[model samples]
Target: MTNVLVLGANGKIAKLATAQLLANPDNHLTLFLRNSKRLANAASDRVKVVEGDAASEADLKAVMADADIVYANLAGSIEAEAKAVVAAMDASGLKRLIWISTLGIYDEVPGNFGKWNHQMLDGGYLETYGAAAKTIEDSDLDYTIIRPAWLSNNDEVAYETTQKGEAFKGTEVSRKSIAALVAKLVADPSQAIHESLGVNKPNTDGDKPAWY
Candidate 1:
Protein backbone atom coordinates (compact mmCIF):
# COMPACT_ATOMS: atom_id res chain seq x y z
CA MET A 1 0.00 0.00 0.00
CA THR A 2 1.24 3.50 -0.80
CA ASN A 3 1.14 5.66 2.31
CA VAL A 4 0.37 9.24 1.27
CA LEU A 5 0.84 12.22 3.56
CA VAL A 6 -1.02 15.43 2.68
CA LEU A 7 -0.14 18.68 4.41
CA GLY A 8 -2.71 21.49 4.37
CA ALA A 9 -5.29 18.81 3.86
CA ASN A 10 -8.13 21.28 4.37
CA GLY A 11 -7.13 23.25 1.29
CA LYS A 12 -9.31 22.99 -1.79
CA ILE A 13 -6.74 21.29 -3.98
CA ALA A 14 -5.54 19.09 -1.19
CA LYS A 15 -9.08 17.90 -0.43
CA LEU A 16 -9.57 17.04 -4.07
CA ALA A 17 -6.28 15.20 -4.21
CA THR A 18 -7.18 13.30 -1.03
CA ALA A 19 -10.40 12.10 -2.61
CA GLN A 20 -8.47 10.98 -5.66
CA LEU A 21 -6.07 8.98 -3.53
CA LEU A 22 -8.94 7.47 -1.57
CA ALA A 23 -10.40 6.22 -4.81
CA ASN A 24 -7.66 3.63 -4.71
CA PRO A 25 -8.50 1.31 -1.85
CA ASP A 26 -4.93 0.27 -1.31
CA ASN A 27 -3.80 3.81 -0.58
CA HIS A 28 -3.72 4.92 3.06
CA LEU A 29 -3.77 8.64 3.75
CA THR A 30 -2.39 10.72 6.60
CA LEU A 31 -3.91 14.20 6.41
CA PHE A 32 -2.48 17.09 8.41
CA LEU A 33 -4.26 20.41 8.70
CA ARG A 34 -4.14 23.27 11.14
CA ASN A 35 -7.67 22.40 12.20
CA SER A 36 -8.20 18.68 12.13
CA LYS A 37 -11.89 19.13 12.89
CA ARG A 38 -12.42 20.49 9.41
CA LEU A 39 -11.78 17.01 8.06
CA ALA A 40 -13.48 15.00 10.76
CA ASN A 41 -16.28 14.11 8.37
CA ALA A 42 -13.76 12.40 6.13
CA ALA A 43 -12.29 10.19 8.84
CA SER A 44 -12.38 6.53 8.01
CA ASP A 45 -10.39 3.37 8.48
CA ARG A 46 -8.07 4.40 5.66
CA VAL A 47 -7.76 8.04 6.66
CA LYS A 48 -5.82 9.47 9.62
CA VAL A 49 -6.32 13.11 10.53
CA VAL A 50 -3.80 15.15 12.48
CA GLU A 51 -3.99 18.77 13.52
CA GLY A 52 -0.75 20.74 13.41
CA ASP A 53 1.16 23.50 11.69
CA ALA A 54 3.09 22.35 8.64
CA ALA A 55 5.76 24.93 9.32
CA SER A 56 6.63 23.25 12.61
CA GLU A 57 9.37 20.64 12.31
CA ALA A 58 8.04 18.58 15.17
CA ASP A 59 4.57 18.52 13.66
CA LEU A 60 5.90 17.67 10.22
CA LYS A 61 8.20 14.95 11.50
CA ALA A 62 5.39 13.35 13.45
CA VAL A 63 3.30 13.09 10.28
CA MET A 64 6.12 12.01 7.96
CA ALA A 65 6.62 8.63 9.52
CA ASP A 66 6.02 5.78 7.05
CA ALA A 67 4.80 8.12 4.37
CA ASP A 68 5.86 7.09 0.87
CA ILE A 69 4.79 10.31 -0.82
CA VAL A 70 4.23 13.73 0.75
CA TYR A 71 2.10 16.33 -0.99
CA ALA A 72 2.23 19.79 0.54
CA ASN A 73 -0.50 22.24 -0.48
CA LEU A 74 0.42 25.15 1.73
CA ALA A 75 0.99 28.89 1.47
CA GLY A 76 2.26 31.86 3.53
CA SER A 77 5.88 32.26 4.51
CA ILE A 78 6.36 29.55 1.92
CA GLU A 79 10.14 29.73 1.99
CA ALA A 80 10.40 28.96 5.66
CA GLU A 81 7.69 26.36 5.44
CA ALA A 82 9.47 24.66 2.55
CA LYS A 83 12.70 24.68 4.48
CA ALA A 84 11.09 22.96 7.45
CA VAL A 85 9.41 20.40 5.23
CA VAL A 86 12.61 19.60 3.38
CA ALA A 87 14.49 19.17 6.63
CA ALA A 88 11.85 16.87 8.08
CA MET A 89 11.66 14.84 4.88
CA ASP A 90 15.42 14.37 4.91
CA ALA A 91 15.37 13.28 8.52
CA SER A 92 12.55 10.85 7.86
CA GLY A 93 14.38 9.43 4.82
CA LEU A 94 11.36 10.23 2.66
CA LYS A 95 12.13 11.34 -0.90
CA ARG A 96 9.01 11.96 -2.96
CA LEU A 97 7.52 15.43 -2.61
CA ILE A 98 4.91 17.32 -4.58
CA TRP A 99 4.97 21.00 -3.67
CA ILE A 100 2.68 23.72 -5.01
CA SER A 101 3.89 27.15 -5.97
CA THR A 102 2.53 29.79 -8.33
CA LEU A 103 3.19 30.71 -11.93
CA GLY A 104 5.57 33.54 -12.90
CA ILE A 105 7.72 33.11 -9.82
CA TYR A 106 10.72 32.65 -12.09
CA ASP A 107 9.46 35.11 -14.70
CA GLU A 108 8.40 32.04 -16.62
CA VAL A 109 5.49 33.89 -18.17
CA PRO A 110 6.37 35.95 -21.21
CA GLY A 111 5.43 39.41 -22.48
CA ASN A 112 2.40 41.23 -21.07
CA PHE A 113 1.34 38.19 -19.10
CA GLY A 114 4.59 38.27 -17.22
CA LYS A 115 4.38 42.00 -16.68
CA TRP A 116 0.85 41.83 -15.34
CA ASN A 117 1.66 38.96 -13.04
CA HIS A 118 4.57 40.83 -11.49
CA GLN A 119 2.50 44.01 -11.14
CA MET A 120 -0.13 42.04 -9.27
CA LEU A 121 2.12 39.96 -7.04
CA ASP A 122 5.56 41.63 -6.98
CA GLY A 123 5.67 42.32 -3.23
CA GLY A 124 6.14 39.88 -0.38
CA TYR A 125 4.04 37.18 -2.06
CA LEU A 126 6.40 36.95 -4.99
CA GLU A 127 9.52 37.01 -2.87
CA THR A 128 8.35 34.22 -0.58
CA TYR A 129 7.14 32.07 -3.46
CA GLY A 130 10.37 32.43 -5.34
CA ALA A 131 12.32 31.61 -2.23
CA ALA A 132 10.16 28.54 -1.66
CA ALA A 133 10.79 27.26 -5.16
CA LYS A 134 14.51 27.83 -4.80
CA THR A 135 14.49 25.97 -1.50
CA ILE A 136 12.81 22.96 -3.06
CA GLU A 137 15.17 23.02 -6.05
CA ASP A 138 18.24 23.10 -3.86
CA SER A 139 17.10 20.26 -1.65
CA ASP A 140 18.47 16.77 -2.28
CA LEU A 141 15.04 15.18 -1.97
CA ASP A 142 13.28 14.07 -5.15
CA TYR A 143 10.69 16.76 -5.75
CA THR A 144 8.20 17.92 -8.36
CA ILE A 145 7.35 21.57 -7.91
CA ILE A 146 4.01 22.49 -9.48
CA ARG A 147 3.59 26.13 -10.43
CA PRO A 148 -0.07 26.52 -11.32
CA ALA A 149 -1.52 29.39 -13.28
CA TRP A 150 -4.34 31.52 -11.86
CA LEU A 151 -6.58 28.94 -10.28
CA SER A 152 -10.24 28.62 -11.25
CA ASN A 153 -13.09 26.75 -9.57
CA ASN A 154 -13.99 25.04 -12.81
CA ASP A 155 -14.39 21.29 -12.48
CA GLU A 156 -12.58 20.36 -15.67
CA VAL A 157 -9.50 18.15 -15.44
CA ALA A 158 -7.92 19.20 -18.73
CA TYR A 159 -4.57 20.93 -18.45
CA GLU A 160 -1.00 20.92 -19.75
CA THR A 161 2.45 21.36 -18.22
CA THR A 162 5.54 23.33 -19.21
CA GLN A 163 8.90 22.26 -17.86
CA LYS A 164 11.11 24.60 -15.89
CA GLY A 165 12.67 27.29 -18.15
CA GLU A 166 9.82 26.85 -20.67
CA ALA A 167 7.36 29.68 -21.14
CA PHE A 168 4.33 29.19 -18.88
CA LYS A 169 1.30 28.67 -21.11
CA GLY A 170 -2.30 29.82 -20.84
CA THR A 171 -3.75 32.21 -18.26
CA GLU A 172 -5.74 30.01 -15.88
CA VAL A 173 -6.49 26.41 -15.01
CA SER A 174 -9.10 24.57 -12.96
CA ARG A 175 -8.40 23.59 -9.37
CA LYS A 176 -9.55 20.12 -10.25
CA SER A 177 -6.91 19.93 -12.93
CA ILE A 178 -4.22 20.77 -10.44
CA ALA A 179 -5.55 18.16 -8.04
CA ALA A 180 -5.58 15.58 -10.79
CA LEU A 181 -1.96 16.32 -11.57
CA VAL A 182 -1.04 15.94 -7.91
CA ALA A 183 -2.86 12.65 -7.70
CA LYS A 184 -1.15 11.44 -10.87
CA LEU A 185 2.23 12.34 -9.44
CA VAL A 186 1.44 10.52 -6.22
CA ALA A 187 0.57 7.41 -8.22
CA ASP A 188 4.01 7.53 -9.81
CA PRO A 189 6.35 9.79 -7.90
CA SER A 190 9.14 9.34 -10.45
CA GLN A 191 7.28 10.99 -13.33
CA ALA A 192 8.40 14.57 -12.65
CA ILE A 193 11.14 14.09 -10.09
CA HIS A 194 13.64 16.94 -9.96
CA GLU A 195 11.41 18.94 -12.29
CA SER A 196 9.32 22.06 -11.84
CA LEU A 197 6.22 22.38 -14.01
CA GLY A 198 3.74 25.11 -14.85
CA VAL A 199 0.19 23.85 -15.29
CA ASN A 200 -2.52 25.66 -17.22
CA LYS A 201 -5.66 24.99 -19.18
CA PRO A 202 -5.41 24.16 -22.88
CA ASN A 203 -6.69 26.91 -25.23
CA THR A 204 -7.21 29.32 -22.32
CA ASP A 205 -4.38 31.61 -23.33
CA GLY A 206 -4.92 35.36 -23.21
CA ASP A 207 -3.13 38.42 -21.91
CA LYS A 208 -4.57 37.65 -18.50
CA PRO A 209 -6.51 34.91 -16.81
CA ALA A 210 -10.07 34.55 -18.08
CA TRP A 211 -11.42 35.48 -14.67
CA TYR A 212 -10.02 39.00 -15.03
Candidate 2:
Protein backbone atom coordinates (compact mmCIF):
# COMPACT_ATOMS: atom_id res chain seq x y z
CA MET A 1 0.00 0.00 0.00
CA THR A 2 1.11 3.55 -0.73
CA ASN A 3 0.90 5.74 2.33
CA VAL A 4 0.50 9.37 1.27
CA LEU A 5 0.73 12.43 3.48
CA VAL A 6 -1.11 15.39 2.06
CA LEU A 7 -0.12 18.73 3.52
CA GLY A 8 -2.56 21.59 3.16
CA ALA A 9 -5.37 19.12 2.79
CA ASN A 10 -7.94 21.89 2.90
CA GLY A 11 -6.68 23.41 -0.34
CA LYS A 12 -8.98 23.20 -3.36
CA ILE A 13 -6.57 21.18 -5.49
CA ALA A 14 -5.58 18.99 -2.54
CA LYS A 15 -9.22 18.13 -1.92
CA LEU A 16 -9.65 17.18 -5.57
CA ALA A 17 -6.47 15.15 -5.47
CA THR A 18 -7.69 13.41 -2.32
CA ALA A 19 -10.68 12.02 -4.21
CA GLN A 20 -8.46 10.83 -7.01
CA LEU A 21 -5.97 9.24 -4.62
CA LEU A 22 -8.72 7.46 -2.71
CA ALA A 23 -10.00 5.95 -5.96
CA ASN A 24 -6.97 3.67 -5.88
CA PRO A 25 -7.73 1.14 -3.19
CA ASP A 26 -4.05 0.63 -2.46
CA ASN A 27 -3.53 4.24 -1.57
CA HIS A 28 -4.03 5.41 2.01
CA LEU A 29 -4.00 9.09 2.90
CA THR A 30 -3.18 11.16 6.00
CA LEU A 31 -4.64 14.60 5.50
CA PHE A 32 -2.69 17.29 7.34
CA LEU A 33 -3.80 20.86 7.77
CA ARG A 34 -3.77 23.68 10.28
CA ASN A 35 -7.39 23.06 11.21
CA SER A 36 -8.39 19.43 11.63
CA LYS A 37 -12.02 20.41 12.11
CA ARG A 38 -12.16 21.58 8.51
CA LEU A 39 -11.72 17.98 7.32
CA ALA A 40 -13.43 16.25 10.26
CA ASN A 41 -16.00 14.72 7.95
CA ALA A 42 -13.41 13.31 5.53
CA ALA A 43 -11.86 10.84 7.95
CA SER A 44 -12.29 7.15 7.27
CA ASP A 45 -10.50 3.83 7.59
CA ARG A 46 -8.26 4.78 4.67
CA VAL A 47 -8.12 8.44 5.51
CA LYS A 48 -6.65 10.10 8.62
CA VAL A 49 -7.27 13.80 9.16
CA VAL A 50 -4.80 15.58 11.43
CA GLU A 51 -4.34 19.20 12.35
CA GLY A 52 -0.85 20.74 12.32
CA ASP A 53 1.11 23.63 10.92
CA ALA A 54 3.37 22.87 7.98
CA ALA A 55 5.85 25.37 9.34
CA SER A 56 6.52 23.16 12.33
CA GLU A 57 9.10 20.46 11.71
CA ALA A 58 8.00 18.60 14.84
CA ASP A 59 4.43 18.49 13.60
CA LEU A 60 5.52 17.32 10.17
CA LYS A 61 7.79 14.61 11.58
CA ALA A 62 4.91 13.23 13.63
CA VAL A 63 2.88 12.63 10.46
CA MET A 64 5.89 11.55 8.41
CA ALA A 65 6.20 8.31 10.37
CA ASP A 66 4.19 6.19 7.95
CA ALA A 67 4.18 8.36 4.83
CA ASP A 68 5.91 7.05 1.76
CA ILE A 69 5.25 10.18 -0.23
CA VAL A 70 4.72 13.81 0.75
CA TYR A 71 2.57 16.10 -1.37
CA ALA A 72 2.66 19.71 -0.27
CA ASN A 73 0.07 22.22 -1.49
CA LEU A 74 0.66 25.26 0.63
CA ALA A 75 0.36 29.05 0.60
CA GLY A 76 1.59 31.94 2.77
CA SER A 77 5.10 32.04 4.23
CA ILE A 78 5.87 29.26 1.82
CA GLU A 79 9.64 29.43 2.12
CA ALA A 80 9.57 28.79 5.85
CA GLU A 81 7.10 25.98 5.36
CA ALA A 82 9.29 24.47 2.69
CA LYS A 83 12.27 24.57 4.99
CA ALA A 84 10.29 22.93 7.73
CA VAL A 85 9.09 20.20 5.38
CA VAL A 86 12.55 19.46 4.09
CA ALA A 87 14.04 19.35 7.58
CA ALA A 88 11.26 17.16 8.90
CA MET A 89 11.46 14.78 5.98
CA ASP A 90 15.20 14.50 6.39
CA ALA A 91 14.82 13.86 10.07
CA SER A 92 12.25 11.16 9.44
CA GLY A 93 14.43 9.57 6.72
CA LEU A 94 11.71 10.17 4.14
CA LYS A 95 12.28 11.14 0.54
CA ARG A 96 9.91 11.44 -2.45
CA LEU A 97 8.16 14.82 -2.41
CA ILE A 98 5.67 16.46 -4.72
CA TRP A 99 5.53 20.22 -4.38
CA ILE A 100 2.90 22.52 -5.87
CA SER A 101 4.39 25.78 -7.05
CA THR A 102 3.26 28.53 -9.40
CA LEU A 103 4.26 29.51 -12.94
CA GLY A 104 6.86 32.23 -13.80
CA ILE A 105 9.16 31.12 -10.97
CA TYR A 106 11.89 30.59 -13.56
CA ASP A 107 11.06 33.61 -15.70
CA GLU A 108 10.63 31.11 -18.55
CA VAL A 109 7.32 32.37 -19.88
CA PRO A 110 7.84 34.11 -23.24
CA GLY A 111 6.47 37.17 -25.01
CA ASN A 112 3.85 39.57 -23.67
CA PHE A 113 2.47 36.81 -21.50
CA GLY A 114 5.76 36.63 -19.65
CA LYS A 115 5.72 40.35 -19.11
CA TRP A 116 2.14 40.25 -17.98
CA ASN A 117 2.86 37.38 -15.64
CA HIS A 118 5.54 39.40 -13.91
CA GLN A 119 3.14 42.30 -13.56
CA MET A 120 0.72 40.00 -11.82
CA LEU A 121 3.05 37.93 -9.62
CA ASP A 122 5.94 40.24 -8.85
CA GLY A 123 6.72 41.74 -5.44
CA GLY A 124 6.54 38.84 -2.91
CA TYR A 125 4.68 35.86 -4.27
CA LEU A 126 7.14 34.72 -6.92
CA GLU A 127 10.17 35.38 -4.76
CA THR A 128 9.07 33.28 -1.80
CA TYR A 129 7.77 30.51 -4.04
CA GLY A 130 11.02 30.43 -5.95
CA ALA A 131 12.90 30.17 -2.70
CA ALA A 132 10.68 27.27 -1.69
CA ALA A 133 11.33 25.43 -4.94
CA LYS A 134 15.02 25.99 -4.47
CA THR A 135 14.86 24.45 -1.02
CA ILE A 136 13.23 21.33 -2.42
CA GLU A 137 15.63 21.08 -5.34
CA ASP A 138 18.65 21.50 -3.12
CA SER A 139 17.56 18.70 -0.85
CA ASP A 140 18.76 15.12 -1.26
CA LEU A 141 15.20 13.87 -1.49
CA ASP A 142 13.69 12.75 -4.79
CA TYR A 143 11.27 15.53 -5.60
CA THR A 144 8.97 16.76 -8.38
CA ILE A 145 7.97 20.37 -8.41
CA ILE A 146 4.72 21.19 -10.21
CA ARG A 147 4.43 24.72 -11.51
CA PRO A 148 0.91 25.47 -12.66
CA ALA A 149 -0.12 28.36 -14.85
CA TRP A 150 -2.94 30.75 -14.01
CA LEU A 151 -5.59 28.57 -12.37
CA SER A 152 -9.25 28.28 -13.25
CA ASN A 153 -12.08 26.41 -11.55
CA ASN A 154 -13.04 24.57 -14.76
CA ASP A 155 -14.14 20.98 -14.34
CA GLU A 156 -12.09 19.71 -17.28
CA VAL A 157 -8.79 17.92 -16.73
CA ALA A 158 -7.06 18.56 -20.06
CA TYR A 159 -3.53 19.84 -19.63
CA GLU A 160 0.11 19.62 -20.81
CA THR A 161 3.52 20.10 -19.25
CA THR A 162 6.77 21.95 -19.89
CA GLN A 163 10.06 21.06 -18.21
CA LYS A 164 12.22 23.45 -16.31
CA GLY A 165 14.15 25.86 -18.61
CA GLU A 166 11.51 25.41 -21.33
CA ALA A 167 9.26 28.35 -21.95
CA PHE A 168 6.01 27.80 -20.07
CA LYS A 169 3.05 27.18 -22.37
CA GLY A 170 -0.52 28.49 -22.49
CA THR A 171 -1.99 31.05 -20.12
CA GLU A 172 -4.22 29.03 -17.87
CA VAL A 173 -5.19 25.53 -16.71
CA SER A 174 -7.89 23.96 -14.59
CA ARG A 175 -7.32 23.12 -10.94
CA LYS A 176 -8.71 19.68 -11.73
CA SER A 177 -5.93 19.14 -14.23
CA ILE A 178 -3.32 19.81 -11.56
CA ALA A 179 -5.08 17.39 -9.23
CA ALA A 180 -5.11 14.73 -11.94
CA LEU A 181 -1.41 15.20 -12.49
CA VAL A 182 -0.75 14.86 -8.77
CA ALA A 183 -2.66 11.58 -8.69
CA LYS A 184 -0.73 10.32 -11.71
CA LEU A 185 2.53 11.02 -9.94
CA VAL A 186 1.40 9.26 -6.80
CA ALA A 187 0.55 6.19 -8.83
CA ASP A 188 4.02 6.13 -10.38
CA PRO A 189 6.45 7.48 -7.85
CA SER A 190 9.48 7.05 -10.10
CA GLN A 191 8.18 9.41 -12.74
CA ALA A 192 9.34 13.03 -12.90
CA ILE A 193 11.83 12.71 -10.07
CA HIS A 194 13.96 15.83 -9.63
CA GLU A 195 11.99 17.50 -12.42
CA SER A 196 10.04 20.72 -12.33
CA LEU A 197 6.97 20.67 -14.55
CA GLY A 198 5.03 23.67 -15.83
CA VAL A 199 1.41 22.66 -16.38
CA ASN A 200 -1.09 24.42 -18.65
CA LYS A 201 -4.05 23.86 -20.93
CA PRO A 202 -3.06 23.36 -24.56
CA ASN A 203 -3.66 26.21 -27.01
CA THR A 204 -4.83 28.62 -24.36
CA ASP A 205 -1.83 30.88 -24.84
CA GLY A 206 -2.62 34.55 -24.43
CA ASP A 207 -1.17 37.68 -22.89
CA LYS A 208 -3.34 36.92 -19.91
CA PRO A 209 -5.84 34.31 -18.80
CA ALA A 210 -9.17 34.51 -20.65
CA TRP A 211 -11.01 35.64 -17.56
CA TYR A 212 -8.58 38.44 -16.86
Which structure among the candidates has the greatest lDDT? 2
The 10 consecutive residues of candidate 2 with the worst lDDT sum are 102-111
TM-score of each: 0.98, 0.99
Model 2 scores what on Cα lDDT?
0.97
Model 1 steric clash pairs:
none
lDDT of 1 by residue, 77-105 (tens): 68889999999999999999999999988
Clashing pairs in 2: none
Model 2, runs deviating above 4 Å:
none
C-alpha lDDT (0 to 100) for residue 122 of candidate 1: 94
Where's the lowest-lDDT run of ten residues in candidate 1? 203-212
**RMSD, one per candidate, in order:** 0.8, 0.5
Off by over 4 Å in 1: none
